[model samples]
Target: MPAIADRTDVYLERFNDALARFADEPTWLLERRKRAMERFLQLGVPSLKHEEYKYTDLSALADGQLLFATQLAGAEAALPSYAAGSSSDRATGAGPQVLGRIPRGARVQSLAEALRSQPDLVQRHLATIADCEDHALSAVNTAFFSDAVVITAERGAVLDEPIQLVFGDGPTGRLPRVLIVAGRNSAVQVVETYAGSGTYWRDAVTEIYAGQNARVDHYRAQVESLDAYHTGRLQASQERDSYVGSFSISFGAAVARNDIGTRLNGSGCECSLDGLYAVRGDQSVDHHTSIDHAMPHCNSHQLYKGVLDDRAKGVFNGKIFVRPDAQKTDAVQSNKNLLLSDESEVNTKPQLEIDANDVRCTHGATIGQLDSEAAFYLQSRGIGAGRARNLLTYAFAADALERIKFAPLREHFEALLLNRFASQES
Candidate 1:
């Protein structure tokens, strides 16, 4: 890896070289890209000393030489078969592809198209919710992203079918961007699937804007190559009486880091964040989430669980903040981890910072191996030892899986969990 000081210059050079590709873009977007590039340079690449990234290292990403993907190659193969009939909008490393029918009351288009057709709407929401000043990776994404998938749910529009987005990695690396805007009283669900091969890196950022009384459900599944590196950020802003549910599952990549943040910007808003990560061998996964109760009468709940085995490592740090003016705020956060091997390790921290006097908030974390008694009981029922352990692990993960209201996505994850554990049986 290059020295910490050189990393900034490397990325800066790349950013400068990438400006040629955006020459045809509008002046405002060009300016935004420049500003994001500056911020990325200012923050530089994070090291172990950085408090927010202390648990996850980015050296591998910084050391690699990856060029920005500029072509659409092999994206068709990356699209999932299950999403065939779903809203036909898919995004590959090159950009968004419109092949299938879109549900009513929703507009799904590529970011480039949206910028041209709905400049006002795209400008109003893009880069407004996610903070780039403090997040170097997000800044990098904002600066280098070639194209994005934009999904807009019109006012009072109820989308019956979920929007499926597939993002494939590029030859070297890719920066994937997604923006979701749910208008007043609108309801929609979005499912994002990331798949790629080789040792490429995927840096992704997703922003969700939920208008008054709107409901947005988001599901993200990352199943990249085992030798790849992935870092993603999900940020949501909720207006009055809006509801936002976010679920994330990670099962691939050598090193993966996920950051999720939600801001309750209006009263009576409710936010729920749930995540599950299962890793084996030398893989590592880290998740950091923050929920800000900026308004009174807002509620937030978070539950994140991890399963680690065979020297794998996992980290979960969740924080909930209730501002001084957020009276009657209610928030709960929990992080749990199950280690399937003696060599596996996990670090969990759940924190609550409440300034409001009349608010209710609670946070807790747990890290432990599978219950020996539970495994023993299952084995005594004529089940093999390996099968008993696998069953216990599945049961521990079922809670979060069951919370997924989308039946198809939930079933997909369940199958992944079963196959993941069963394949490793002794």
Candidate 2:
């Protein structure tokens, strides 16, 4: 455990700086930031004693010892479509890269730009969907966030391509926010990519809103510096008959934590949350997810898997809450982990709180090493022992990969996963 720093003054400075930068921002947003700053001060950074953050420590991060505490450069230049087989620009220190193309008519704008052009749209949804009081990280992000990406689909519009938002950390830390809204009957996909060149702490928040009967697919890839500290929160609200799917891939960062929450505010909403993480070499990854079934007949499915090696650590805590009125709800949650090294550790917990007697809910968790029998069977086929082990490890993670509906994105992640396994073998 590291010593805790008094960040009250630090956050006060940050809040003042943000206010100065956004002096022209709407009064509502400014007031929100003021309130959020107060909340941040009151809550402070969560210590290991904090139940929600018990697994991943943030002392170094809170003190800005691990991060440079640098200021945001400016509005990020639009990233080019990522090219296949190319390393991320942040990883390679190369020029910008592009992957999948966004569909025509879909709107993707930086929050700064949105404020200028679509202030009403940004004002209506921004900071309105997420719970600021539940998490200190959320409050901090809300108070200090300076830049963000916003994407939207008009009512009844169908987007063929997914929108991608890429971010790279600088010498100092960065607080990036994302807002995505899908109008009634609209369909769209959003991909968020996080990477960096140097050690820094990144606190990010992404909020998604799905209108009645809308469909939204969300994905995130975290490949920051190996020495970086990353904490993020993702929240979503779905309307009647709406659908949302979230996919998360985490492979980098010395200390990484993700808090995901979804609220089924309307009946008949459906959601799927899936994640895969590969951590090695003393790194740590933590994921906490909550699905709130607030209305009747809402359905949710969640699965999170991880592979840890070389003294690495992983944590998963998943919770589902079914309100009294959420009758006939159907929910399933699972967390599975594979330990490749005896020294590695993983803590997994799955929880369900149901108030409706007629609702159906199931939760389960499993933690173990790679199957020795399966490895031996493969080795007997003339494959090298190391190769056999790697194959099985890849297969274990492939389940979540296969669930990705986007072919190009799936391939990209597969390549990264294979590269990760190969590196571990060496």
Judging by lDDT against the true structure, name the best candidate: 1
Would you list the C-alpha lDDT of every candidate in the order shown? Answer: 0.82, 0.79
What TM-score does prediction 2 earn? 0.90
- The lDDT, on a scale of 0 to 1, for candidate 2 is 0.79
Candidate 2 regions with alpha-carbon error over 4 angstroms: 1-5, 65-100, 170-173, 419-426
lDDT of 1 by residue, 114-232 (tens): 88778998888888788798888888899988888889999999987677776664432378888999999999898887777666678899999999999999988888778777899
Candidate 2, residue 233: lDDT: 87
Model 1 residue runs over 4 Å out of place are 1-3, 67-93, 96-101, 170-173, 423-426
lDDT of 2 by residue, 21-66 (tens): 8787789898878888787777778889888888899877665444
User: Which window of 10 residues has the lowest lDDT sum in candidate 1?
Assistant: 63-72
Clashes of 2: 6
